[model samples]
Target: MVDRDRDKAAESRRILERISREADTGGASLVSRATKRARNHVSATDADQDDWIEQWGTRIGRVLGLAICVGLLVWLVMFLLRGA
Candidate 1:
């Protein structure tokens, strides 16, 4: 019974060692694959982001300016009407 227990323990250790080695190799492969994919991907650059922000900012500024002009005109008309 003691020998059987020892044999079982040895077998468990061998299995664990093989599993650990396999896991390590698998993890390394995963990292390498991810790195390769990142290198190949053409993602957004800083210039692209800056251009996008500037484009939106210009558009928003124009809209806001138009709104302000319209609002001022409305207010001026109301004031004149009230005074009259």
Candidate 2:
């Protein structure tokens, strides 16, 4: 019975080692494939700055427009309250 238990433990260890090796190989392959794909991908470096500038300009315009609208509303309210 003791020998049987020892054999079972040894078998389990062997199976675990094999699984570990297989996982290592598969993980390496996946990483290499992902790296290769990333290397082949064309990142948009040229348009990054242009996109940022355009977005910033749009935001500034929106803020300015909002400020003007709020100012006009406030002025109109004050004028109406002043009875002309």
Candidate 3:
């Protein structure tokens, strides 16, 4: 029973480690793919097209994030000015 418990713990630790690595590496891959897409203006192949779409999506996300941040800042300023 003790050996079985140790084996289970070891397996769980490995699974957790794998998940951590994937999460850390996945973001880099996405960023690199997006950068590659940005560099290629003309995508003659399907993969290029896919990367372009991903980059476009990332660009739009950045824009939206900026807009939200600006809006929040404006709202905070107004609230402070109003003494709310």
Q: How close is candidate 3 to the true structure, as a TM-score?
A: 0.41
Model 3 segments more than 4 A misplaced: 1-50
For candidate 1, the 10 contiguous residues with the lowest summed lDDT are 39-48
lDDT of each: 0.71, 0.72, 0.73
Candidate 1 residue spans exceeding 4 A from truth: 1-50
Model 2, residue 33: C-alpha shift (Å)? 43
Candidates 1 and 3 compared by TM-score, better number = 3
Q: List the residue pairs that clash in candidate 1.
A: none
Residue 73 error for model 1, in Å? 0.3
Candidate 2 clashing pairs, residues 3+ apart or interchain: none
User: Against the true structure, candidate 3 has what lDDT?
Assistant: 0.73
TM-score of each: 0.39, 0.41, 0.41
Off by over 4 Å in 2: 1-50
Worst 10 residues of 3 by lDDT: 39-48
Order the candidates by lDDT, highest first. 3, 2, 1
Candidates in order: C-alpha RMSD to true structure? 18.6, 17.5, 7.9
Q: Candidate 1 lDDT, tens digit per residue, 1-84?
A: 999999999999999999988677544677798877544332323224658876566556666776799999999999999997
